[model samples]
Target: MKIAIIGTGNVGSALAQRFVQSGHQVSFGVRDASSPKSQKASTIAGTTLLSIEEASKLAEVIIIATPPEAVLSLVAQLGDVKNKIIIDTTNSIRTRPEPYATAYHALKEITKSNKIVKCFNSTGFENMNNPIYSDFGGIDMFCAGDNKEAKALAQNLAKQIGFSECWDFGGDDKVELLEKFALSWINLAIMQGHGRNLAFKVIKRA
Candidate 1:
């Protein structure tokens, strides 16, 4: 997969490194390649740094790991994304794109693209860096979207990064619900001091 990560923050860099290690071609799309964050992400082997537009053009999949509000301005830079798959890994807990409830909503409406999915937002960057636990093996991931193909691709990417499963949260209406799920993790891991080493997994009895 030719993946373009739009941010170079903790979550973005973590996924980028894991994806690169999984043998996928990764590129970082940034406002300034020389910026500290972008420079740091560029240090990852087998990855390239390019302007936002350039990176978007070269990628088959575009992962938005930036702040939720950043998607408002990114609409213009994400040229011809109609044929590409967009995986939104943001939660609008602190700030959302105006006129839209979430970054996923903003991207779908502004870009008029149906191939969008909300994913990789339900846990901390530590989990994304390493989903495997000594006991549980691989933690589960969750994704929500209306497009079946888009959701399938998102689930595949999650597994490629060592997630055991990428459960389907639901259709478009469940996007916010998934964000709220992320908040639950934040509350436990940060507010309640449960520690970032924790993760969630679904259990079933056969």
Candidate 2:
């Protein structure tokens, strides 16, 4: 998969490496190609740095790892996202996108694409970098969106990166719920000091 990650922060960097390792072509999309974040991301093997518009145009899958509010500004730069798969990995915890509750909503509205699912935002970047935890194995991931094919792609991407499972939290209405789920992770991992090493999983028995 050709993927362009918009944002070179912790979450973006971690996913970029994981995707690249999983045999996906990864690139960092940014306003400034020479910025410290972009330059640093370019150092990662199999990752390139391109302008936001340029990167979006070239990739089949576009992952927005940028801050929630920034999506408003990048909408114009996202170009014709019409039918591409856009996995939004941002939370509105610190900053909502105003008219939209989260980046998922914002992207869905502005980009005019239903192939947008919210995933990869539920845990610390450390966990995403390497989900394995001794005997426990890889941690679970979660996503929510209306498009069936989009959700499947996101789930497949999750599994490709060592996530034990990618639980479908349900459709569009469940997006905010998933974001809140992400906040729960943030609260416990940071606020409660339960540690970032902790993760969530579902156990079922027949």
Q: Choose the strongest candidate by lDDT.
A: 1
Task: Report RMSD (Å) for each prediction in the order shown.
Answer: 0.6, 0.8
lDDT of 1 by residue, 1-206 (tens): 89999999898899999999999999999998888999898888998999899999999999999999999987799899999999999999999998899999999999999999999999999999999999889999999999998999999999999999999999999999999999999999999999999899999999
Clashes per prediction? Answer: 0, 0
- Report residue 123 deviation for candidate 1 (angstroms): 0.5
The RMSD (Cα, Å) of candidate 1 is 0.6
TM-scores, one per candidate: 0.99, 0.98
Candidates in order have lDDT scores of 0.95, 0.92
Off by over 4 Å in 2: none
Range of the 10 consecutive residues with the lowest summed lDDT in candidate 1 = 32-41
